[model samples]
Target chain A: MRYAFFPGCSLETTAWDFDRSVRAVCRTLGITLEDIPDWVCCGSTPAHTSNASLAVALPVMTLQKAKHMGCPVMTACASCYSRLRTANHKVCSDPDERQRAERVTGKPYDGSVEVRHVVDVLVNDFGLDNIRARVKRSLSGVRVASYYGCLLTRPPEIVAFDNPEHPSCMDDLFKAAGAEAVEWPYRTECCGAGLSMTEPDAVNRLGHKLVSMARQAGADCIAVACPLCQLNLDLRQADAAKAYGAVLPTPVLYVTQLLGLALGLSVGELGFNALTVSADSVLQRCEMVVSAGRGGRP
Target chain B: MENRLESTGTSFLDEVQRRSGTPISACFQCHKCSTGCPIGPEMDVLSSQIMRLIHLGEEKEVLESQGIWMCASCEACSTRCPMGIDIAGVMDTLRMMAVERKVAPPDARAKHFAHSFLQSVRHHGRVYEMGMLVAYKFRSRDFFTDMDKGPKMLMKKKLAFLPIRSGAASEVKEVFKRVEEEKEQ
Candidate 1:
C-alpha cells in the first residue's frame, strides 16, 4: 500500500530515530510512504493554544497536498495525527469552517484525505498476522509499558481510532513485534509538555511520577507515540530525579523503533542513539544480537 | 488569600458547575477524580479536595491552588467520573480564568512563555524559535539555564532561522481582535 507521509518537526530533530524506523518498517512491509512536499509544522501544542484556526489550517494544507498525490496521509507523530484528524473532522462536520479553511489555503478540502496514525495504519491496514510473519527476532523477556500519551486518544471524537481511557493499540503492536506489553496507570498521563522549559518543577514532578509508576508496574522500558512525551519521560527524567533526590532509570522508545527491531533492522537504523536513557540492557535481554555482533541475527 | 476573593465575582460553585457540568452539590465528599487522577499524587492539593473546595464556593483556594496548574489535562477524572463530568475541563477553565484575572500561579513562567510564543507568531506570522526563546528568557528572567543549547540547536540547523508565515495572518489577527471585542463586551 502507498500513503503520503507527514513527519512533523519533532521527528526531524529529537525523534529522528522514529522517522528512520518508520521508513525502515515501511520498506519491510512493502509499503510506499511518499513524503508530503513543503509541509509546515503540524502546530503541535502551540497552535491549539495560540490560534485554533491556524492549527486546523496547517494540517489541512498538508492533507490537500497529500490529496493531490492521491493517497491517504499517515503521521508518525501522535500530535500531528491529532491535529490533522481534528482539522479533517472540523472541515467535514462544519461547512462554514470548511469554506473558511478553503479560502485560507486557496484550495478546496472536502475531507478527501484520510489521516491515519502510524499505529492505526500498522494495526488495521498492515494487520498483526502480516507483521508477525516479518518478525525474525522474538522479544521473549522484554517487558514494555505501552504509553499512549494524551493527544493520540483524548478528545476521543477527533481521534476516533481507539478507546481514550484504555487504549490498547500500542499493546497490540508491541505483542505483534514480539515484546511483552505491561499495564500501567500513568500510561495516559501528561508529560508536562511545552511547560518543560517554563515550569520545569511541575514537569519534573509529573515526569518522576510517571517514570516511577511505570517502573513500579514492572516495565523495562516505556513505549510512546508523541515526541513531546518521549522528551519529558526520557530527556527531563534526570532533572525530575534531582527534585526527589532519587535516581530512577527508565528508557523510552517509539513503538515504531520496537517494530523495526523486530523486523530485523539494526539499532543505528532505528535511531536508538537519539534516546537519552540507554536501551542497551533491554536490547541485551531481547537477545536479538549476540555479545559480539552489532546487528540482530536470527 | 482573602484579597484574591474580592477580585473575581464568579463563585467557586458556579464556576465549577459551569466548567465541569457535574453538580458540585452532589459531590458527597467522594474522591473519585482524585483517586483516578494519575498525576494527583504529585499535585499540592488532591483532585478530590479541589472539587470539594469548588463545591464550598472557596473560589480563592480553588483558583490559587497549584492543583489547577499541575493538572496534565489528561481527562482521567473526566473519564472515571461517576457523574460523567468533565473535571479536566474544569481545571482548564480555572487555569484560563486564573490567567485572565491575573491571579496567575506564582510561577508565571509558563504564561510568560506562552505570551512570548504568541508575540512571535503574531509578528512574524509563525513561530520564530530563537526569537521566541530569547523573548521568553527576557520576560521570565531565566536566560542562562538553556543558553548553551541554543547555539547547538542553531549549529545543527534544527532551529528555523526564518519564520514560516501563514497565508492568513491578517485573518488570524481579526479572529484575535474578535475575541478581544467579545471579552470587552
Candidate 2:
C-alpha cells in the first residue's frame, strides 16, 4: 500500500527518531510513504487558540496537496493527525468553511483525500495479523505504557478513529509488535505542550506525575504518538526527577519506532541514537536490540 | 476585613470571570473539581474554593492565590465539572495574567525556566532544550542544581548540545506572528 506522509514540524527536529522509524517500518511492511513536498507545520497547539481559520487552512493546504498527489495522507504525530483530521472534518461537514478554506488555498478541496493517523492505518488497513507476521523478534519481556495523550482521542467527532476515553489502538499496536501493554492512569493527561516553557514547574510536576503513574504500573518504557509528549516525558524527565527527588529513567518511544524494532529494523535506521533515553538496555532485556546498525532508508 | 476588601479594587468573581471565561456565578459550590482533582492533596486550596472566589468577585485573592501556581492544568476540574466550565483554561488564563503582571511565584528557578522556554520558542519556532537549559541557568544563576545531571544525561547520549531548527521554521514564525497580533487585539 502507498500513501502520502506528513511528518509535521516536530518530527523533523526533536523527534527525528519518529520520522526515521516510521519510514523504516513502512518499508518493512511493503508500504511506500511518498512525502508531500513542502508540507507546512500542522499548527498543532497555537492554531487552535489563535484563530480557527488558520488552523483549518494550514491542514487544508496539506490535504489539497495530498489530493493533488492522488494519495491518502498518513500522519505519525497524533497532534498533527488530530489537527489535520479536525480541519478535514470541518471542511467536509461545513460548506461555508470548506469554501473559505478553498479560497485560502486557491484550490477547491473536495475532501477527496483521506487523513489517517499512523495507528489507524496500521490497525485498520494493515491489520494485526500482517503486523504479527512481520515481527521477527517478539518484545515479550518489555512492559510498555501505551499513552494516547489528548489530541488523538478527544473532540471525538473530528478524529473518530478510536475510543476517546480508553483507546486500544496503541495497545493493539504494541501487542501486534509483541510487547506487553501496561494499564495506567494519566494515559490521556496533558504533557503541558508550549506551556512547558511558560510554566515548567507545572509541566514538570504534571510530567513527573504521569511518568510516575506509568512506572508505578510497571512499565519499562512509555510509547506515545505525539512528539511534544515524547519531549516532555523523556527529555524533561531529569528536571522532573529533581523536583520530586526521584529517579525516573523510563525511555519514551514513538509507536512506530517500537514497531520498526519489532519488525527487525536496525537501531540506526530507527534513529535510536536521537532518543533522550537509550533503548539499548530495555531492548537488550527483550533480546530485540539489533546488533548491527545498517542504516536503511524506506 | 473592610480594610482588606478596600485594598483590592476588584472582587475575585469579576477578576476570575474576566481572566478565566468561566462563569464563577454558574458554580453552585459543588466540590466535584476538588473531589476529582488528582493533585488536590498537594494543593493549598481546593478547586471548588478557587471557583467560589471567582464567583464572589474576590479577584485580588484569586490572582494572588497559590492555587494558581499549584494548578497543573490537568483538566480534571473541567472533566468533572457539572457546570461545563473550563477550569483548566481559567487556570491557564490566570497563569498568563500572572506572568504578564510579573506576579509569578517566588521561585526564581521556576521563573527563569519559564522565561527560557518562551525565549527558545519565540526564537526557534520550537523548544530547544539545550538552549533553554543554558539560558535558564545563566538567567537564574542557579548553575549547579543540575550540574551533575548533565553529565549523566550526556553519558546516556540524551543531551544534544545543539538545537535542531525546524525546516518550515518561517511558517511557524508566521503562526506566532498571527497569534501575537490576536493577543494584542
Candidate 3:
C-alpha cells in the first residue's frame, strides 16, 4: 500500500522518534509513504483558537497538495489529523465556508482527498491479522495501557475515528502484537494539550492523574498515538510524580514503537532510547519472559 | 471574581449562538459538560456556568474568566451533551472574541503563547519549536519557565538547532495575508 504522509510540525522536532518508528513499522508491513510536497503546518490549537479562517486555510493548502499524490493522506499526529479532518468536514458541508477557504487558500478544494490517522490505517486498512503474521518477537508478558488522549476520537462527527468515549483500536493493535492490553479509564481524557506551555501546573496535575490511572490498571507501559500525549505523560512524568505524590514510573511508548519491538525492529531504529522515561526495565522483563519459554500468548 | 453586569439581555447569547453556530437555547443547564471537563478544577467558571453566563448576557464574565482559556478543546463536553450544544466550539468562539475585544483574560500568557506559535508558523510555514518558544518567552517576559527541560531535550536531540525552511513559505504567507484582508472587509 502507498500513501501521502503529512508528518506535521511536531514530528520534525520533539516527536521525531514517533516519526521514525512510524516509518520503520510501515516499512516492515510493506506500506510505502511519500511525503506530501511542501506540506505546511496544520495550525493545530494555536491557529484554531486565534483565527478560524487561517486554521481552515492552512490544512486546506496541505490537502490541495496531497490531492496531486492521487492517494489518501495519512497523518501520525492526532492534532494534525483533527485539523485536516475538520477542514475537510467544513469545506464539504458548508458552501459559504468552502468559498472563504478557497479564496484564502487560492485553490479549489472539493474535499475529495481522504485523511486517515496512522492508527486507523494500521488496524482497519492493513488488518490486525496481517500485523500478527509479521511479528518476529512476542511481547507476551508486557501489559500496555492504550492512551487515546483527545482529538483522536472525540468530537466524533468530525473525526469519525474510533469510539469517542472508549476507543479500542490501539488496544486491538497491541493485542495483535501479542502484548496484553490493559483496561484503563482515562484513555480519552485531556492531557492539557497546548496549555503545556501556558499552564504547566494544570498540565502536571492532569498528567499525574493519567499516569496514576494507568498504574492502577497494572500497565507495564503506556502506548500513545499522539505526540502531545506522549510528551506530557512521559517527559513530564517525574514532575507529575513529585506534584501528586509517588507512583511507580510508567514508561510511555508510541503505539508504533511497541509494535516495532514485536516486529523485531532494533531499539535504535525505533528511537527507544530517546524517551525521557526509560523503557529498558519493561523491555528486560519481556526478554526474561521470552527466555523462560512463555513468550506465546494462549 | 466578577464586576457589575453591563446588560442582561439576549445580546450575548445571540452573538454566541451566531458565532459558534451551536444551539445555545437547547442547553438546559445539564452540567454534563462540567462533569466531563478534565480541567474544570483550574477553570474560574465551569463549562455549564459559561453557557449560563452567555444566556444571562454576562459577556464580561464569560470572556474574562479563565474558563474559556482553560478549555482544552477535547470535545468531551460536545460529545456527551445530549442537546448537542458544541460546547468546545463555543469556547473557541469566546476565546477569539475575547482577543478581538481586548478583554483582559485571566490568563494573558495563554494568549501570548498562541500569538508566538502563529508567528512561527507565519514565518517558517511550520512551527519551529525552539523559535516559537523563544518568541513566547519574549512576549510573555517570563524566560525562566521550562528552562531546565531545555538541556535534557537538547541532549536527547529532541530540540533541533535550526529549522528546515519550507519551500512553500511564501505561498503560506500569502494565504495568511488573504485571510487578514477578508477579515478587514
Candidate 4:
C-alpha cells in the first residue's frame, strides 16, 4: 500500500515516539508512506475557531499538493485527519467555499484526494488477518484500553470512518495483536485537545476521568491515536491524578507503539523511553520485558 | 439574567444559521448538546442555552460567553444531536464572530492561545512547539504554566531545541496571506 503521508506537526516534536512507531510498524507491514513534500500545518483547532476560511484554505493547500501524488493522503494525527477531511467535505459540497479556496490559493483544485488515518489504513487496508500473521509476540496478558478521543471518529458525516459513538477499529487491532482489549466507556471522550496550555484544569479533569475509568476497566495502560490525546493523557497524567485524587500513573502508548511491541520490535525501536509514565509494568505483564532492566529492549 | 432582544433588529440566530449553514432553527432545546459536552462543567453558558440565547437574539451574551471559548470542539454534541444541528460547528462560528468583533472574550488565555498557535503557523509553516509555548506564556503572562514538566520533557528529548522549519514555508505564508486578504475583502 502506498500513501502520501502527512505526519503533522506534533509528530515532529512532542509525539516523536508515535511517529517512530508508526513508521517502523508500517515498514514491517510493507506499506509505503511517501511524505507529502512541503506539507504545512492543517490549521487544527486554532484556525477553525479563529477563522473558518483559513481552516479550509490551509488543508486545501496541502490536499491540492497530495492530489498530484496519485494516492490517498494518510495521517496519524487525529486532528490533522479531521481538518483534512473537513476541508475536503467543504470544498466538494460547497461551490462558494470551493471558489473562495481556489481564488485565495490561486489553484484550481477539486477535493478529490482521499484522506485516511493510520489506524484506518491498518485495520481496513492491511486487514486484521494479515496483521495477525505478522504478530511475533502475542500480548496475551496485557489489557489495553483503546482511547480514540475525539477527532478520529466524530463529526461522523465529515470523518465518515468507523462508528462515531462506539468505534471498534482500535479494539479490533488490539485483538489482532493478541492483547486483551478492555471495555471502556470513555473511548470517545474529549481530552481537551488545545486546552492543555490554556485551561489545563479542564484537561486534567477529563484526563483524570479517562485514566481512572481505564483503570477501573482493568487496563494496564491507555492506547491513543492522537498526539494531543497522548500528550494530555500521558504528559499530564500525574497532575490529573493529583488533582482528582486518583491513584498514581497510567502509561499511555500510541496504538502504533502497542502494535510495534506485538510485532517483536524492541522498546528502543518504539522509543518507549520518551513516555512520561513508564510502560515497564505493562511490558513486564506482556512478558515483553524478560529482565528487570530499565530499558525493556528484547 | 434579563436579556431583551436588541431593537437593532438583527437576528443573531439567522446570522449563525447563515454562517454555519447548520439547521440551528431545528433545535428544540432538548439539552442533548449540553448533556454530551465534555467540558460542560467549565462552561458558563450551556450549549443548549447558547442555542436558546441565539434563538432569542442575545448576540452579545452568546459571543462574550465563556462557553464558546471553553468548547473543546469534540463534536460530542454534534454527534448525538437528535435534530442534526452541528452544534460544534455553530460554536466555531460563534468563536470566529467573537474574535472578528473583538467581543472581549471572557477567557483571555484562550484568546492568547489561539493567537499564539496561529502566529506560530504563520511564521514557521508548522508549529514550533517550544516557540509557540514561550510566546503563549509571555503573552498570557502565566509563566509558571507547566514549568515543572518542561525539564522532564526536554530530558527525554521530547522537546525540540529548534524549530523543524517546513520546506515550503514561503508557500505556507502565501496561503495565510491569501486567506487574510479574502477575509478583509
Q: What is the C-alpha lDDT of each candidate?
A: 0.73, 0.72, 0.88, 0.89
Query: Could you tell me which residue pairs clash in candidate 2?
Result: B11-B57, B11-B58, B11-B59, B12-B57, B12-B58, B12-B59, B13-B54, B13-B57, B13-B58
What's the TM-score of every candidate structure? Answer: 0.78, 0.72, 0.95, 0.96
lDDT of 4 by residue, A153-236 (tens): 988999977999899999999999999999989999999998989899999999999999999999999999999999999989
TM-score of chain A of each: 0.94, 0.94, 0.96, 0.97
Runs in model 4 lying further than 4 Å from the true structure: A290-298, B1-9
Off by over 4 Å in 2: A50-57, A89-113, A245-248, A288-291, A294-298, B1-185
Score candidate 2 by TM-score against the native. Answer: 0.72
Model 3, position A201, has a per-residue lDDT of: 87
The order by descending lDDT is 4, 3, 1, 2
> Lowest-scoring 10 consecutive residues by lDDT in candidate 1 chain B?
B174-183
Q: Cα deviation of A56 in candidate 4 (Å)?
A: 0.8
Per-residue lDDT of candidate 2, residues B1-185 (tens digit): 45433426375555656655566567888798888665566567677897777665565666666676655444547755778777766775666666666776655244456566545655665556678778987887767654655675555444567765555446546644654565466
Per-residue CA lDDT of candidate 3, range A1-298, in tens? 9999999998888898899999999998999999999999999998888898998999999999999999999999999999999999999998988999999988899988999999999999999999999989888988998999899997899887688988999999989989999998999999998889888889999999999988899988899999999888888999889988898888899999899989988777788767999887677856833222212111
Highest TM-score among the candidates is held by which one?
4
TM-score of model 3 (CA atoms): 0.95
Report the lDDT tens digits of candidate 4 across residue range B22-101.
Answer: 98878899998888889999999999999888888888898888888888889999999999999999998998888889
Worst 10 residues of 3 chain B by lDDT: B1-10
